[model samples]
Target: MPIRARGARHRTGPLRSPGFLRSLVFAAVAALAAVLPAPVGAQAAARPTESRPIYSYESAVREAVWVDTGLDADGDGRGDRVAVDIVRPREPAQQGRKVPVIMDASPYYSCCGRGNESQLKTYDAKGDVVQMPLFYDNYFVPRGYAFVGVDLAGTNRSDGCVDVGGRSDVLSAKAVIDWLNGRARAYTSRTGTERATAGWTNGRTGMIGKSWDGTIANGVAATGVEGLKTIVPISSISSWYDYYFAKGAPLYDGGPAELADAVESPDAQAHCAAARQKLVDGSPRSGDWTQLWNDRDYVLRADHVKASVFVVHGMQDLNVRTKNFGQWWDALAANGVERKIWLSQTGHVDPFDYRRDAWVPVLHQWFDHYLLGYDNGIERRPMADIERHPDQWSTDRVWPPSGTSAATVHPVNGPVPGVGALSASPAPAGTASTFTDNPALDESSWAANIDKSTPDKAGFATAPLTKDLRVSGSSRVSVTVTPTTSSAHLSAVLVDVGPDTIRNYAGEGEGILTGTDRTCWGVSTAGDSSCYLTTSADKADVGFTVFSRGWADLGNYASDRKGVPLTPGKAYTITLDLAATDHVVPAGHRLALIVAGTDNGLIDPPPSRPTLTLDLARSGARVPFVGGAGAFARATSGARPNVAAGVPDGTPSSPGIPVPRMAAQRLPGGAGR
Candidate 1:
């Protein structure tokens, strides 16, 4: 019953009992534990494995370092220093194992917070990060990865002026990536002379975030930073010009300067005043193309992107607008960058809140494959995951689906005298419709009673569809108009004219309903909880919905760079690109198009009001159909004369879309998230 040691004399007395053998084994384990690094938090220090956790979450190391950017945005005479808070597995670095970095460089860490809970980073007396705001650090650190939360220049703990997506904002994050790859310098303290290096990293990095944070990811990727392996930009901007203007039409009165002022910290405001003024002087409200806009336009530099891109956006996000992701996605495709995309129907909402069940694992696989060099084959899978309805998602081998093609539809005279019919064939020669420009009425006002004639807008509708028709991508309107004034503003909207239950974006919740119940994503600590409020779809029943919309300045019809007033009453042709969309017009539902002027809250109006006469024979819309023209033709084989009859009288309310980056401006001076 007693265990005997090799070559040792047979044990006598108490050593012969089984309890004594057990005591000896227990004592040996205790001796080994004392000599080795104490087992992490009540359990043995986890060892790296092909699958499962490799380290202890409780023992992850937390530290702060200030990365020095070469730019002097605040005119402080010294290069800007961006505060980078890092969380990594302590055992890996101690064991001489290097891990990849998952970074989120943002201007919102202290200003607006992050995620549904509106969490801010918490630190201890030593100024080391004790708790991070989001689940990135909690979920990935134990899995053999490092998470870095960076405060962009001029925000939070960083020292510089907020450039609002300009060079300073972009390069501040780039400097961190450069430091990881040994190309830039960092210090343990903000003003410390001593240098620090990222000896724990493998020199591979991935940047990710939502809104302004995500926009920084796009800007940094455009610089072609070598160590950045990929980026996941959600509801982000590709061009700051597009953020404030659309086709030579200003979307808002405030430009980059206002946004900069909104996010700059109180202590930094005086230092940032000159930088903010530069933003105002460089970005003219006249919508002229300038070097300033070129510096913030990432789409122009898509070819410079070597990092793989994972794009996520809401189709109904009027704040950032769908065009931002659409143009950026197209540019990335043209450059042959490895990419994936997720498109949702919600307005300005993050996928984590809407599709957390699926988003987390997909994101994990993406990072593991791209950042950690895992052979997970995520790149070989389908490229798109599209949310067609609330809680309903579908995957496609390619975005816009494979068979998408343009199908031309024109407006012709309907049975109702003034109401126009959208037909597959062009209208009769010499036919024309006229409407006066009204700056007061927006797309919502014109969307109502679309089957009836209105003085301010021209409405055209298709007959009740005999079969389901889907518009897969962006739509275009090429119209030849003769205006009564020298300059005019133009707007186009594609509407799904049918009763349906959709996300209640018009409500306070925007598109999702947050509940009292909470769900946890990762490990939790006293200062930070990985748990967050649960969310469900908030539905609203509506008679009709505006699925796609676009705006342009008639004076800038010839070029987006400059506006040249047209001769009154002379015909000029211009093509307007509708926002990219993927929507299904169900069988028995009608598809309608509305043409108007000055979409109120969306873009600034021109000084003159124009009554434009449209040449119907030369005016038509090119809609992206899933199966091209033939399928569209088959869906509407016979044109019904009165397409507008029997449609719902009630109109949908304005979808309460949030202002872009408004959440990030949650502080005293901020406005958008």
Candidate 2:
């Protein structure tokens, strides 16, 4: 990664040895030490290193302040003040040694909680933060960096109504960045009239978190705020609309207002009731694109983003969904933003939970390069680190491997009516297959019986692969359907039919089994422990894996923003985009596509149960295959399943990936030693 001199105060000169850099730092500190503010025993300005800690974490300063956001979502007369908890090495303030900030702004800090342990913030007698959640405070503060945890407005110590992803939600976090730069006002206390300022350090900042916490990082970065150098958003949502809806199709019966109500602090309920009401009224069930969604959307404003982005997301994250990252990443690339990504196979999990040993060191280098302005060559490394299988990671210079292209594969009728084969050759024109709506059937049920005829769905499978075939990106299913009713719902599921032992994300633990053994991440304190319960991969033996899926309300066939009711027996062509993915089908596995109505639990059923006829010639999936159509054709042209050719049925069915060895080095956990 080429380093860009982002801030005016930071300079990116020619690369030299670490020893030379330290010497330069010492000389500068000596020349200015007389004029600089130095406490009784403040040491020479400390330099950050990837392997060593030079600052005293136990002696770090800890405090809390309220930054004023110029908004009144709760209809309160005064501007809302957002809570910011700070933990930093004392040397920054005492010795005039400035450091960059690593901040995680979240609404969950006080409500649902954060991390695998679900830890929440704790305060001491003076109302100063005694314990900040997660290992950021423990790890980074000892490395001469400040870790700031911010409570989003309407949650925790912040004052305002939870606006969901609306103005209050986005602006409150942005206000903290502004306060660090002396552009926004803050208070010593939530209701105090006295002012507070961040005078202890340089303003370069990086935001990171998972889920809603990470979502705020994206929102704030999109504001193009100065002093925000980078952001690492893990399992985050780039568009709130995408989170709850898919191309105008609502995944749940509820809307944004219900989410606002769930996370709203108890004290804020009364004041925020009207704000919640507005969310309900503004978001119509009709799935129309409203100002509310537009305001919450960061993709549209991707051009406004100035911060470099480090995106981390699970390929199978159904809650926040993969499209949020997919669309946002594309837009960022289009605008030439500096970016890096880590795509994992787990569903809605933090990398720290699964890949802790690797995650920590990489994260440290990323922050060191971007926030602390160290030329660590992290940016120059591969742009993507993707986990293609269980615990199997590969680095790529570009995602989708360089040669990936969309290849259309059509469904061909077999001797039986409903069951079909997928081929590169187009099916006969006007040929159609029919299936009745089965509101009870989900993707799993549809995929499990792909080769057999069923009333619930029309299934198509390719011949067993002769070689591994990889699908590297999002796919689209286009079909012309004639339905018995004016309104209908359609779904497409892509499955790898074979035997394999994979992460059991569908299980209660959601892919990880927490064990009694505790692994320490950083130093520990009484209020907060850096040691957490160790987790192992929860693997399951499975015959079929649903790798990608898509859903659509046929009424929004032409435009996601507008709905056009269909006339009975009239054919309408609709295309639905499957969630983004990267998966490999082993040689013996058959790649299958199942088309059905009502994904059941995923999306609510349409009012009418419509038996539909699909035009086979016009309907097919456009897949992003690694070697394009040629590779897909060669893989699927073999006469028999590769298993018959001595390929083992349990080729990739290993129990689980072995646990990585953890490092023993520790940093401070929280405040008190």
Candidate 3:
């Protein structure tokens, strides 16, 4: 094996892109203010003379209004607009306190709502906002802050087509920011009649949200908008393409436009039918990168990000995927952007749902430190706050930690070509691994019986570890192979082959289950509830779960965007990247690499299935295992139906990738340390 190693430490966060760039020259120029303040950084640390709370929770002015987006997305000949529902302190203006703002711009307001319960927004008879989902308004309003809920254009009262991450979606909320700082214009009606402005704001603002809402924040901040002091995007999509595609593989046979339709309004779907058709037309089904996707990709424009980023993401989030964060995080770091990250084991969940007690106050301090410009000393803290175990978190100076190194494991051909050992030592020359593509087998079924031979897939394993191994970052697999067909889709998955242990994720819960009881960390109001369902994730041993997986279409070996089909009898070298991860493999555990021609469980099977012949002599995998060995040395010391049958994490089925069945399901009792 021609093994190579790299041990560089780096930071991680979160993603952003597209056609909007063509209209960039005509884009709006002004940034906005929020929290109706005197001026940014005015009264550094002075206390108010007023006896009442500057931000009175009981007396907040709850109002609903519209902001002119200045675009006719539906060809209605009228400017598209967005609805801004606000709840702010009634006493701030009198206290001479121009408060900074915290805003949540979401598309879920009228659809799925927010939080674990999916609470939607409610309004009064006069069309004024009566209810705003989540505890943001209820908690922050009393603390001298304004909580603004904005309905993205085409959803709720906002007017326009749902172009996904296109102009309509981005500019609607941006117009609200403009209205605050006096940069752009807004109106009181969807008819473009009455004008409106933010006479009650301080101009400086910070955006906070989870999932799609968080994605919007990331997209807007990437526009280099001024007054956007910071953004807290949790488990959000940085690239819609990344959201729907993996290494050129489409998710559920749908592309970006289909996703746009998923979130689009039913009434507007027909109105935007032409636009939707254009979306489908522009998005290439061949998996080639297009300007359309580029226009919507925030990561491509990350260099323009001026706002400090406080990112929160579940590392196990298969929905949005950590790739969205890790890739964008790298770009932001390369551009020297200031950032902080919270990497949780939970999948697609808010920190409030994961870590309730510490999340709110920590968030408060973060917003105060940036939006309020208060000397909260939050910047003095570590760069990363990572969850080491369920309900157990610790801070670190940097992510991927410091004392980490990379290692490469090669395929060791033996009894048969496709059957082998993964090691640091070189395999004999002319060795090969062959498997015809099969869509039926999953990661578990293919790898579970390594002792038995199968023609559908290939399996390789390393000797038991002699010391504890910690892998932190993305892993890669490159192979020299010959295919029997022009096109081939290969799935490479990294699996942890080990004894029964406490799995971090049992069905996306991160070993934490939502219970019936409720816990109120903060005060709640009628409209905004602070009480959330509690979590119950025990430190119990469970089954084997996929560590990370990556896929590649053989036709795209030359470029991720373009495809060059292989000649039936010729050899080609293809490389696939496993998901970025930070996992600890115990000394007695084994590491396995499973490769197959197709993962029908995750994607649609191509019309033609191809048989692949891998030259094991040239095939190898590189693991960014932090502090591992120079060789795959031998160990000195050394599941059930659905795999997580009695594991008890409360998650229904495994999310993203399913756990390997019979890997290690049944577990006896052991108290959590």
lDDT of 1: 0.79
TM-score of 2: 0.88
lDDT of each: 0.79, 0.78, 0.68
Clashing pairs in 1: 661-672, 661-673, 662-671, 662-672, 662-673, 663-672, 663-673, 664-673, 665-670
> Higher-lDDT candidate among 1 and 3?
1
Residue lDDT tens for model 2, 197-234: 88986899999988887888899999999999999998
Q: For residues 1-673, what per-residue lDDT tens digits would candidate 1 score against the true structure? A: 1111121012111133466466545544543443356655853442211222335667788899999999888887898899999998897678776889999988777767787666788899999888798778767776668999999899889999888888999999999999999999999999989999999999899999888889999999999999999999988889988887777787777778767666677757878778888898998878888889999999999999999999998888777878889889889999999999998888777788888777777787888788866555688888988877788877888987889999999987666555777888999999988899898777767776676678888888877777889898788898888999988888989988777777765455557888997766656666656667889998877767788988888878788777787899899888887888889888777788888888877777888999999889999999999999987887787645433554322223433222232222122111224
The superposed Cα distance between candidate 2 and the true structure at residue 240, in angstroms, equals 1.1
Best-to-worst order by lDDT is 1, 2, 3
Cα RMSD for candidates in order:
9.4, 8.0, 11.7
